[model samples]
Target: MELPVRCFVKAVRRCFLSYICLAVFCGCLMGIALIQMIDGSFKMDIFERKQNVTKPRTTTLETPVHISPLRMKELAAKRANKTDLKQKWLNERIERLNKAAQKVQMRREVTARPVEPSDKFHIFYYAWYENVQYDGNWQHWNHEYLKNWRKLDTKVYPTGKHEPPDDIGSNFYPSLGCYSSRDPITIDIHMKQIRDAGVGVLIVSWYPPGLSDGAGRSSDLIFSDLLNAANRHKLKVAPHIEPYNGRNPVNFLTHLKYFVRSYGNHPALYKVKKNGKESTVYYIYDSYRTPASSWKELLSPKGNISIRGSAQDGVFLGLLVDVHHKHEIKRAHFDGFYTYFASNGFSYGSTWKNWKTLSVYAHKNGLLFSPSIGPGYIDTRVRPWNSGNTRHRRRGKYYDVGWRTAISAGADFFSITSFNEWHEGTQIEPAIPKSTNGYTYMDYEPEGPNFYLNLTNWWVNEVLNKTVHF
Candidate 1:
């Protein structure tokens, strides 16, 4: 109050400056408090743009409330897992819908259209099945469970017979129900399926006229019907020489003669004219079961009992199980090799990764390379303990992968493992969704009964359009 006018002005200026600074500090604290109240993370972004995808997926974009680091990590993991689950579910739903639409479109063409035979596609056909309607009783439907294959495993190997029609031996149920192979209607239907699928040849399982495999009946009569049906479909027939009770090099010649005299005149008997020579084709199943020395006697030109120069001589293919079979096949003078197992990694021959090496070996050795393709494999119903070889179809992805591998391996020809080998669950024939009291059977869900047939038709076209020469 007693100071000069200039000093009084300076004091007033300092007091105003200090008051303004205090007010600014108070405002900053309130701003911080307001931000915390809104979002704990405080990771504000002015440009919070949406993703530019065709169908933007729902995702969590904000951070959690303040918590322990461990708790935060756990929450993040849960969110990530949830996102992954949503993605998987969406993908499956899309696939199912697409297949449903595709199924509807394909059904219209399936029955009306018939794909012509290229003779490059072969399908393994079976004829041992029997039913009460066609045969006297349910012969093969009530199949016996084989002894435990895995001796070391102590799992219950359920023994006894498969009680059908409520129950059957296979894990899959047929769309046609339990039917006989000899039934005329069944044969016609099978022929139509094969023709519609663009298959050219049927490698029918064969045994000497009256012989068969374990718990199976003679199939020679059924084979005759198959020939007629094949004729109607304009498809060729090749005999799959199964290892019967007394199959040997000496008797094989006789069998060959019998085939020539028996069904040789039929137009459906698959034959080829290579280098001015005409002959039929024979698939030797479990060919390695016999000694390579034994096979040489029949296949080699200079052997004591050779079929090389004979008129009945034909192309011979052997089953390959292991690496040694490679040398065995060559030494035995086989015309070709086929990896028949449906499970991809079940054996050295069946492995997808081994196809290239095998193909190269076959080509270098002047042997035909025909890789076997299967929809899937599951023999748990018959061989209960041997679950290691089971292959799940995963809708249709498994089959597509098989086709891709075959084409990439430069397969000389494509052979489906089975059209109806129900015991091993490798059939591509129609199968309906069926469930019984005790268990539910496997079916091609979402896709119809003819799913594999349609899928096969697509692949056959793919192979034909390709530059691969059969």
Candidate 2:
């Protein structure tokens, strides 16, 4: 049992090392077991430190629960109330709409579906400038003409009412309550279309003729054919006069005297007489340029002419009402305003409603409201926006707003901006086919027969019979 001291020490060291290694192995196994107990599974000792070494258990965050719908309804009921005036207003409007719908239904029952293009609808053509002068002939290009017009002698509609498109007539065709000069043949063609469409009148775009050397003159040739055609067609002719363009009181009275004397007896001539006298409607295009005082003076004795022939004058001034510059509308003293529409610009969408509200105020003040409808908007190109979208949707929902707004405004009449303003691509004229946003030629889907025919008829029906409110 006895050994050298060095050997005894070495043996003791070996025993100590063995005992330490056994204790370390047992400790690792226990740690792994503990980790498995917590995790509900077993893993190698290498992963035991990662699992069993957790500092603490986490507490889950509580989620808030919503109240029941029954409680919400009770709360809402306690606060809910509607004003009598608002309720009455809504009811009256609904009643009006219902009556309008019923009337439309009745009309459909009575009048056969418009099978003829001419019979379908009527639109003011000259305002859009789709009619151009070519070789002493005024050539018209419109959306309807472009999409459906055939080069044949007679343009036929589904209803088979074939009327040769005149394309030639007088130079001065009445339009949009005014008169403008074009080739005689062009005017004739335009008039024929109006007649075919069953349009009741042509609001001639008129201005006194200016001299070759910037001097004032008695009249323009534009009025010559308008009066003649209007007389012949038994269509009402209303001449819009402007006194500011050297149309002073004397000249105005002279022109009025001439117009009334020459065409007064014609069946188509408009004579709005009240209190035993012929009334004149001087639709001033630029009311601000020519003040109300000018109008007053023109109708007065000092400006020239005798008051003897002067009778009841119901002057209706037309101007584009800018809501931002509403002061212009208020200051102009217009009997009514002719508001314009651009489907794309700032005036599109919700702004249309604001214009409608303004229209209501104008109507309440005895002003006749006339608003414009165009193919689309191009004002952004003319007056570029500093920021945001410079372009707009031309064909889709954009164009619909103007059409719907015009109806909703209970518009006195709808003035389609152009039958042919092709540069902006809003022409309803044939021979010109181009599509720009909001100003596309035909923005309809099935693009051939049904769209154009139905559209024309719809516009015609709305203008002739329907009533709308915003």
Candidate 3:
């Protein structure tokens, strides 16, 4: 045991070499055991090489493997927390995007130029004109010639003579003849005439898409052209909603949305100050067809489809055909009232004497009162049975009387009965002295062709100059 230092060192080296070899042998055994456990190939090869090999004995261990349920729950909770955070981030992002879009829209509305003034005169304009060649056939011009038209006709017709443009169904004949609304020249002429007359707004007769009055064709296609012309002449346009086939509050709300989305940005679309907010104006003709309850569903502040204080909000002016309509309009939450009939004594509201009372009622209820006036009314050629309702022109005195009455009544605005409703003989558009096929057309007479236009300009100036505190 007490040998030399070199011999002891050599023995230590040999012992280390033997330990290394033993470690290598154990590692090789572990690798082989792992391979045998992972793959059944070793046992299969053994069985194939020695078909007489016996099965090995197996032994069981007493120790049992354990897992921590608490640790598993902690891992699941961490994963759920990650998912919730992701979802929360996504929701916040969406909310932020929506808010940004709202801001942009608001900014656009704020930045838009104010083209329409708070106080201005408006006129009811008809755009339901068509040409026989372009429109495929004679339309409203031959309304009296259709089947059952004779039965419904209140006027006497000649045996077999039906003249168009000059001696058509309407009592009044247009100087420009029967022209299409889509005609650029006609639109230009209309815009110039309206502008020259100092009318700030034109409430165009409008129906839902694909719908039109029984006698005329649809004017929806010409709206854009009309707007373009109006813009060029610095005139604003409001929609006069006519009765459609199936119009309800819910559907009307959709129509309003469509109008706003389509033309709200246009400079020519008429907008006015309403309840401290600038909004578009819509004149609803024959709105009583839908009940006040239904209208309240959209017009009232607490309505389900209310546009109050929203960007798409508007001032809806209901037709006031009678005195009782004021109460109905108030109940329906309309913004204003307008008399559409040209005949002065036709209705309570249309009569010149009742305007002051109606205006007083409107003021009490904080509603706008706009009285409609016309030059004259004579539809004998169209409704001979109703000739009693006709009011003679009296050489422009009738129109002057209406203007004076409207001015005295303290109207918030003034509306002309029509610019081109020739059927009712209410059109202030120029009429020519025409004689065709034994039918003689009436003319302005004594005055030039621009008589009514000049009269309108004078009244418009008066309206603009006069100031009322209320």
Candidate 4:
């Protein structure tokens, strides 16, 4: 009986030990699950906080990792600082522009002299040549006349096998030779020559910023120097705005604003007074490129973006290429019209006989008529196929005829075709008699180099002395 009781006690003890081991294993599993839940909740909180503080990063099927709150704060601070700096810089620029405009107004009020209508003789000026500064690239000098000499179909070679600064690609050669517009001495000499010739204004050829003719440098690159030289010589400067790529009404408005803000402050900038109000004058080359409707947007007094009668208002002269262009100019609300071509019969407006009629029409319409005169026209070197347009100098007879016609028509304003357009053989700047390896250049031979200059002085004095009704 005692042995059986001892066996039962041992069995009961074994069963109780197994139950305790099972309890310990279950407790370990529950603890691991609780820890995992707490970790997941903490990660979710962090992601929520990041989303609230910063811009959400793009995410795909893969979950995004949350950036720390400290890092997000740093990024926000950096962006704020950058924005502040940009705003401050813009403000400073605006302030500077305003100050410049004010100074210009004050100076003009104190010292500006009125230019008489009869004394106004404007000249077409070019600033597109290069020299050693361009490293012998022969920029507009070689390329403008003949893009590829090998492909040229002319009977005569343009340059005559001689390079620039000696024998260039022109029917006539300059006394100063192939010169760079960038040279300070050259600029000074040019200013002196024009002033001595009795020219009152220099209508400088200009293109938009970063734009230029084929192989030519931007005209704006030398504009500051030109203005400085003109100021020193007591000559006024006006922009001959050229048509550029992508030009339209919108961009043109921007360009005008930029022009006013940039060079309008210069003392040499040209201005005209009407009814006791002084305004700048701008010559728009190829103004017909933009439709009259587009121009009305900026020129009409009541149109949007209109500068007319505003602080930026000025006399806008459109190119007179055809008789019908006068109607177009009037429809576009242009202030005046000017003939630019040197060749008298090249265009309807350039015809000498039409000057008096046009001048009469202009006066009736309250528009100014400015006739352009040239000594001659010989662009065979540039346009070999178009020789019909060449007009001989006739030893100054042609020029005298043009001047007489303009004066007889009662023109109050006059513009010379060019001061130094060697490529077109219309330069009034002195030209020396030059001959090269196989070519001969035209010049004011019987007279001296200063013959044209003397003639110009005489004509200018005559024009000023006459009574001009405008």
Candidate 5:
């Protein structure tokens, strides 16, 4: 066996080699198995490098913005100055108004007239509401009757086709005046119409007096018109100052001059008798409110030009005293005064009895006196009436009675309440009493003469000419 073992030494080496190879193979297989067991992933790699960092930079705290004290003070001073300026403006305005008021009061005291029945008393009406002016545009005109009336002739009024209606004779409204548009054409036309119609004198309305306010501002506008009208038509213009306003004296005087200078020589300018000097007619609405100061200023010796213009020779100034304020007669400052009443008011019933007494007083004072009459009152449109105060028939029974009473009192100049005041149910035209038609706010119907016109005609024959026909 020993000999055999020594002989197989090489063989044994060979066998050992074979064994090592087998072991190597087994290790390789194990490595492959481990790789398969675990999950594998492929990734894209990227690399970026930045600059080196330096020491942190230091920063300083910021100071807040501030406003200077001087600027604040400057703003406050500006505001105060503005306030002072406004106050000064208001003070100046008030002072001017006061001075104007004082001037008017003074005039009323000196130039007032007393009533004289023996003198010629004229009846007039304010017919402004019928002013349908034509300013190139027909849309501004409101009088349709004017167009029809104008077709009659140019002798009365040559005003354009769109001119106002000459409705004063039948449908007059008290809201109109000749000076409205500052255009002399209207004045000329108005005067011509009055002259052609045989209207002796026009009793126009005036304001800025005690009974009226700034309504008198437009008075001057018509001053130039009055001059033109008077010169052309010999139509007199009598401005009736309303005693309701108690306006500024300075303003009134200013108007006074404008009226006199512009129409001084006009043939239509009012004349007191025949050879009087002045060419103006001043009619006060009431005697009571004629401010004493205004009277003194008008007739004072200071020689104010305005007073002289108004008081020059031909002037015939008069006053109208409403029954409501008749008590002021004792203190009235005027050249001539007249008595008028509102029979529509319940109080008028009692006041009617006082007409005789007032007439006697006016006659004794050497003053010119006139009276007014009308149908019962019921101004339903302007002021509504209750059941007991319904509108009266146009020619109601009371209308004739009222006329008789006025005539009996020797009322030479009688002013009918109105020509066409439909609101008062006193319109005689359209035959209020017998006609089926009630009222036409402004329309004119041939069938009726309107209550005012009826009364006017009556006065023309009975009072004005002392003759009555129908």
Candidate 6:
């Protein structure tokens, strides 16, 4: 009887040892799975799906060992603490590995990529702002609250002009509080910002010397100052013809000659070679309002008022607002077309989702398609009823997607909708946090103020480095 009892005890000991070995083997497998899973790649998700099957462990509670309830709880807590510690350590390890990979990539890019601005990048620039310090009073910053025509109750939208220096027209306040565009110091700072972002040209809003837009003075007065500042930074400047009084193709051609005669020799005046001729580039806003025949008369090489082969000839980019403008631009004999509206899908040409189709069509027709990108759009403060058009900036994610999608859609050249069109809240210029007059302004939270600029520089380098293939 004694020998039998001893044999049973030996058998139990052997069985217990076998279970421990099996559990250790399973734990090793789990550790390997965790390592692969925590790498944070697409493969991790796929691996997780394949290994989702659960194999129950007959340990602890299922074991025949006897223990008080309190003792069991303490053991379970200890086990949980151990798991949490392991997870924390694992995450730290993964983070270190990822940082190391980024360091290697940065080294490679430093050797391969040039940080200088590329001519392919164009930024829409506005110079309509004014302030008391520079101009004796605020201009666009005191923008009036626009009426919402659709709403019968006018009270639905706020009325009156915005008070400057504290309350501005924009939803996001600028870092430069109530700054005047004519300020040389401010202009220099702007040029440096543009250059830092690797932007090559500033497509400035322009009207004739005396002509001006509503709510602000004529931008023409500031052109010389802009040109000087831009030249200092080795940046080019192009005139963006705004829709103003008495603007037609013939008169616009005359204005082109005027610009040539006036600022033609300015070092900052941007010129591009096209159709085997050297000419400055110009953007015609609201071009759809003009008849195609009228433009053809001015742009066609053999037309009655053709500027072709002349000194004032320019590579003109017409604003594309609707789908039919695609054919009109070609018919009008314009050099190219650009989608200007920052609000994506607000116009047929500005829709990001339609860019692939648009690019394909442009390629087939042999026209250059420059898809305009905006960081975000929000004019709700000025146009209170235009909430549908407001595109929230998801802490810089919005701008990132715009860059990625544009490049992925085979866009070789693209334009930013604005550098400082603050009225539309599309400005990539730095913005700061503010709460004034009981209004809390939005900011680029989870990111620094210069995040957009840094991001633009990064994307520009990524493309120019030949690392990210279009």
TM-score per candidate, chains pooled: 0.76, 0.50, 0.70, 0.70, 0.48, 0.75
Q: For candidate 6, lDDT tens digit of each residue in 395-470?
A: 6667767877788777746789889999999988988889988999888764657767766777788777757643
Predictions: Cα RMSD each = 14.1, 14.5, 28.1, 27.2, 28.2, 19.6
lDDT of each: 0.86, 0.47, 0.80, 0.81, 0.45, 0.84
Alpha carbon lDDT at 319, candidate 5: 46
Q: State which candidate has the highest lDDT.
A: 1
Best by TM-score: 1
Per-residue lDDT over 361-431 for candidate 2, one digit per residue giving the tens place of the 0 to 100 score? 76777666666665443322222221132224343234446667767777765555444343243433333
Candidate 6 all-Cα RMSD: 19.6
Q: Which stretches of candidate 1 lie over 4 Å from their true place?
A: 1-114, 467-470
Rate residue 351 of model 5 by lDDT: 42
Whole-model alpha-carbon lDDT for candidate 6:
0.84
**What is candidate 2's TM-score against the reference?**
0.50
lDDT of 3 by residue, 195-313 (tens): 88888899999876677887576666678888889999889999999888788898888777877887888999998876677799999999888888889978999988887878778
Residue 389 CA displacement from its true place in model 2, Å? 12
Clashing pairs in 6: none
Candidate 3 CA-lDDT value: 0.80
